[model samples]
Target: MELYFLGTNAGVPSLQRNVTSIALRLLEERRSLWLFDCGEGTQHQILKSPLKLSKLEKVFITHMHGDHVFGLPGLLSSRGAQGVTAPLAIYGPPGIKSFIETSLTISQSRVPYTMDIIEHTGGVIFEDKYFRVEAAGLDHRADSYGYRVVEKDLPGSLDPKRLEAYGLKPGPQYGKLKRGESVELGDGSWIHPADVLLAPKKGRVVTILGDTRPCPGVEVLAKDADVLVHEATFMEDLAELAHEYYHSTAKQAAEAAVRGGVKSLFLTHFSSRYKDVEHLQPLLQEAKEVFEHTRLAEDFGLYPVQRST
Candidate 1:
């Protein structure tokens, strides 16, 4: 899995950065893309990347802020125009359904595919065979949220050497054994999967938070996550201003990452005032002081979330 940062600015767009939108590409796992936040000009940013609109399977909105949702309707309409027939699911806080429906109605937009808009209060919102998503209410001016995406543990692979010991070669029987099934040999003897399978591998965890101040919900959603994408909207010196605006400073975000025990933290949703890399270095440095593995997110940056051994 990989995270594609479509926009990384806070509140509004700037010459260097756009607003907040992130695309989680699950191409290897599921051949789909799951978006977190669709800030204004998000579709425009996607066009600049290698992402395909047709692969967009789900969208998770963090809040109702215009910077986070203004591009959603336009993107949906464009997806319809592109003739993508696959169904899409959207999860967000209450009033999200109304927001999408109202925008589509006012614009007279027609989406050809099935769209499932789920306005969840909190907790587990989605779960399939491969992944599970849980939401936690966050501290913000609006009813914001953070999402924890937990990938299901994968089954162990069949050992080729062990199969060879049983006089088996690569074939459909190996496929069945790999699936944890028992296979009958030509001699009428049965071979169990455990006899040839290796240890199961652990899945990865990714936590993405919307605009918020340092809160318990952040800790809950980010605990032990392989990747924690948190909004660092201000520098350490602006802690008071950040608190007042229901936003987090880089230092605060890194502290939260430490508290959550996340493997790595990616700081995003930067204030537009930091126009250049030189201006933004302090934010990253401050975060690094608290969490050594903290990284500053940039527009169009692709971060790979590798599986845990």
Candidate 2:
């Protein structure tokens, strides 16, 4: 899996960065794309990337802020023009449904595909054979949320050479053995899978938070995450201002990532005050002071979500 940052600025669009929008590319995992937020001008941002609007299977809104959701109507309408007939599901806090419906209604826009708007209140919002998504309320000014995307563990790889050494040739039985199934031989002896199979490979966990300050929910939602994507709306020096605005500072975001034991920390949602890379370097340095693996996100940058071996 990979994370594509379409926009990373906070509140408003800057010349260098746009508002909040992140795409989790699951082409290899599930053949779909999951959007984290649909900030203003998000559709335009997507157009500049390799992501396909037709592959957008789901959208998870963190809050009802205009900067985070103003692009929903345009995106949905454009998806219709792209001839996306597959069903789409959107999950978010309350009022998200009303916002989408009202926007589409006012514009008289019609999407060709069916859409399901789910108002979630925490816990598991979606689960399938390959993955599960859990949501938790965050400490933001509004009813913002954080999402935990957990990929399910997969069966261990089967050693075909080992099977051959055991007088068993590779065939349909090998497939069954890889699935942890027992097979009976002509001699009526059962071949157990545990004798040849390795331990199951653990899946990767990623946590992405909305606009939030320092809170207990942050730690709980991002525990042991492979990658923790948190908002750093201010520098370490302006921590008080960050708290006043119900946002997190770069230092605070690093602290949370360290506390959660995440392997990597991605600091995003930067304030427009930092106009250029030179201005944003201090924020990245501040976060790296606390967490060595911390990195600052830029618009259109793609990050790989590495799995823990």
Highest-scoring model, lDDT: 1
lDDT of 1 by residue, 203-266 (tens): 9999999999988999999999999999999998888999999999999999998999999999
What TM-score, to 2 decimals, does candidate 2 have? Answer: 0.97
lDDT of 2 by residue, 1-309 (tens): 999999999999999999999999999998999999999999999999999998999999999998899999999999998888999999999999999999999999989899999998899999999999999988888999999999999888876666776788878998898878998988898888986677788999999999998998899899999999999999988988999999999999999988999999999999999997789999999999999999988899999998798
Worst 10 residues of 1 by lDDT: 155-164
- TM-score for each predicted model, relative to the true structure: 0.98, 0.97
C-alpha lDDT of candidate 2 relative to the true structure: 0.93
Candidate 1: stretches off by over 4 Å: none
In Å, residue 217's CA in model 1 sits off its true spot by: 0.5
